[model samples]
Target: MDNRTNLDDYLAGLGISDAEESAPLPPAPDTTAAPLPDAANESPKAVLERFLRGLIARIDPELSVTVRETEEALEAEISGENAARLAGRDGRTLGAIEVIAYTVLAKQEGRGDLRVRVDVGGFRRRQADTLTKLAERLAIGVAKSGEPHELQPMPAAERRVIHIALKEHPDVMSESVGEGAARRLIIRPRHS
Candidate 1:
């Protein structure tokens, strides 16, 4: 299928792998770089960007798309007035978009996994900051009170932020409990 066809056709850039793990993205788009020999001589990043541009145009003309090839994965940052709306509450909507993007794009014949990541209105960054601080505060409280604190159920990405935030914490540790959508992070005082 032609990627540039429409939003529904190209919203598969953010699908997760079998292990439900995040793939590495790219750095930045090089304007003068030679194009890959794809359907239109465009690289994966180029194709994804073109597809996102068309998607954004349909959603909100004021919004803009910037696709960067990080050393990790293809990062698409959407920004503008209506960006927060697309971001959804706590980035749930953006997560949905990312999942669809990855699943769809990865299944495109020889595409394999495109390693695409999306952030709407910088929601990922801001949410990471908030989650990190919350984790730290809860960890401290758990350590002092000798009690465990179970936070609200969160998605894998959000739970990852909390785990990583307290990875080296001296007094507390983090763990995820429950299953599927009910999975949540728990902070507890270190046993030792």
Candidate 2:
């Protein structure tokens, strides 16, 4: 096919017409440096807590944010009437804030490569429990039917919950497939 034909085919696949295809792409994001916190003397956890508290206060003054550190990671939890708003639909907003918090903390002088997780109203814990139960039910079905089942796309942290939930299942095996946004978990019966 000629270049025009190939371009037309690609645009058609994306449900875009020739006129729509001519629209300019969005501008690139600004790369200017953000102001860093004065974290030189603060511990990693302290700095993370300070940032998270300020973030929650700006969003909702009634909400309270707290941070706790464990050997594995730092957990930041928000509790209040408006905390669910931070959870967003399917926890996207909560996840994004967690990512930004981790990035900022890791860049601080004393908190290199710190791991921080943000949760609103115990949403993460409840979501993990729900996912684990669903995984168990699906694994049983896949084992009985001897058919592989692909789960909905989930973030890496959520996918990890699925894997851990089924790791000890006697008749089912779990594997992650695809890449990036399309990545998901597949449950299949183990071969005897």
* Predicted structure with the largest lDDT when compared to the true one: 2
Model 1 lDDT at residue 37: 32
TM-score of each: 0.73, 0.75
**What stretches of model 1 exceed 4 Å from their correct place?**
1-37, 109-114
lDDT of 2 by residue, 1-192 (tens): 597567445333322223343333222233332333344556778767766755664577678778899998888889998788789998989988888677657655334567788899889999999999999999889988999999888889999999999999999999999999999999989973
Highest-scoring model, TM-score: 2
lDDT of 1 at 160: 88
Candidate 2 ranges beyond 4 A from true positions: 1-38, 110-112
What lDDT tens digits, residue by residue, belong to model 1 across residues 59-173? Answer: 7777878889988788999999889799777677888778765655554425665687899888889889998999888988998899899988888888989999999999999
Alpha carbon lDDT of residue 170, candidate 2?
92
Q: Clashing residue pairs in candidate 2, if any?
A: none
The lDDT per prediction is: 0.71, 0.75
